[model samples]
Target: MPPPRDTSVKSTVIPFDPAAPNARLRRLVHHDVLERWRAADRSAHAPRIVAVPGGDGDDWAAAALVTARPHTAYLKIVDAVGDVPTAVEAVVSHARDRGLAQVKWEGWTVNPEVAALGFVPLSVPLAQDAESSGPGAGHVRWLHDGEVTEPPYYGQTTHFTCGAVTALVAQAHAGELARESFDRRAELTLWRDATNFPACEPVGLGVAVRRAWPSSPVTVLLDTERPVLLDQYPQDEQEWRAVLQRASREEAGRIGVPIDSHPLSMTTVRSALGRREHVLLLVSLADMQGFDVPHWVLCHGAVPGALVIEDPWTHTAAGDTWVDAHLLPVPDLSLDAMSTISPDRIRGAVIIGRTEA
Candidate 1:
């Protein structure tokens, strides 16, 4: 392969300004394929962008998107017109300023040069890592330690209903129904009931719960009013914001849940667990899926240095399908890092079941 083109680029990292005139988000995203979260995805923390000075009388050199999630400020997306190393430096500088552990790149979609940089996946690449989970594997540390097992495993049949499947697991654990009876696996009726199609968001499923059980004590908590997956992301913030705001309002009004525009905490989640409250949590799957995306899993209990998760997605790695999905223990710091919906959106879990009178 030919050596990467070098243009003696000088790049700077800046917080993405969605409201700026002639904002370059749409064009940038098209260039940065691995950057998962769009402006529509930013219910709270908008990601930072890298800007490079134009060379040879050119208008620009390069641009890229980076995130501020706890694990690492991800550097997986870029629109390069010059030296990639300079752009990488700009992203790294921003990550260091934020006091993050590392800068991550895409594991699945990494090109040859990016792969040569040798950034591993933020979390274990697969659910079953033999080295990580060997004879003394931490993954098996919480196997039978009374960490609220019996929630049962029912994977998502469709790609979009991770939220619904996670909710079902929580409901079962909360005594809304027994595990076996609740195994609807892939029938997708529950997801269809929960989701707002076309937009592909898992909103208003809480209303379905109340409808099924009139006396159910489920409380739906939402932290943002942003419409999900909007038009492959609009370059104009206001043009996008109008549609986002409208959808959020409609969804919130229809679901009848109060929409909070702030962060939630893991401590709150722990408190709910203490009261035998099972929770459906919104987490970034950067660790699991190789880039940041909204994913839901049922939190069974907290163990030493980790949280036990009952993931709704089936483990893709063979022979360890059930082994990996059932009560998977993610490292505490890693769990803490991934347990958010947005940068500013803390505690993105919806606590349901058995509210006090």
Candidate 2:
């Protein structure tokens, strides 16, 4: 039988600093795992450690590493030697105090204690860990009284296929494409069709989507006349990519797809999502992942203060799974800031709408 819940036990939130390592945390979590946590914490959304005191007056009974997004707090690691329920209660209270909507626990194995505390199992895919057997199970407890369903998640098979995967996910969510068709073959094929050589430029991807799904309305928003996503390459490469982008713009015009020469504002994006339209946003991962790589994410839903996005690429080295990427609630201001990429502050998006009856 499991131990009874200790109401007297209280959990304390400790700010995690890799520089000044906590001796207790070091004792609880392994060295390698702590190193991984350190690397992940380099992001803007760094995690905190929640420590629960033991019933016998020990320094810690249970502890968890948690990070807060817009409307949710994600528990990346949980270590319990005493009252598990009380520790979870403290975590929930922390989330509540921050006005969060839910608490997600990344569980490696099935624990009845967490299940007893009302953490329902999420239907995530099995192949989360590419190196090991798997990152076992995932659970979530909603704090508020509302229903929020996550869109289907498909991790990009290759580094350059994020644009294709986001486009595919948007189509699948809108019932324009089959869910089963989100495979490597289709992903690579779409990437081949859409890519401006290596990266999928906004115009090229928008044109490919328009040609692939004629019924769905497609619109491209780019605030620049110069070549995008090729600043890292040589001048010759940039020239060729610019030419390709020009050709893609022409194709977009011929195909009846509107290429708006303006930045897509957050207000417009919110309004489009409200009308059940999916937007493919190009964002830099510097703030989120501590790197300045340009990536594509699909905006599918909206909460009160956040936009729900599906990032096709998972940071596997930082121990991220599909759970971390799918249905992620990013605050409006943060999304707006990240979506503006490059030194030129170039903004780009591809708006896809359902078929008109």
- How many pairs collide in each candidate, listed in order? 3, 1
lDDT of 2 by residue, 223-313 (tens): 9877788879998988988899899988988998897886678998999987889999999987777678899999997766777788877
Per-candidate TM vs. native? 0.51, 0.85
Candidate 1 local lDDT, 1-357, one digit each (tens)? 212322333566667654451244443334344333322343123456676655653443556555332232223332332455566556555544544323444232334455443332222222222222211111111112233345555656556777777776776666766655664442266665555552224345555454455455555555655554344454575365445446645655664554444566667667767777776777777665555666778777765445667776643321123334555555556776787655434445555657345
Give every collision pair in model 2: 286-291
What is residue 54's positional error in candidate 1, in angstroms? Answer: 64
What overall lDDT goes with each candidate model? 0.50, 0.74
C-alpha lDDT of candidate 1 relative to the true structure? 0.50
- Model 2 weakest lDDT span, ten residues long: 126-135
Best by TM-score: 2
Name the runs in model 1 displaced over 4 angstroms: 1-147, 183-187, 198-203, 229-256, 315-320, 342-347, 355-357
Task: Return the lDDT, model 2, position 29.
Answer: 67
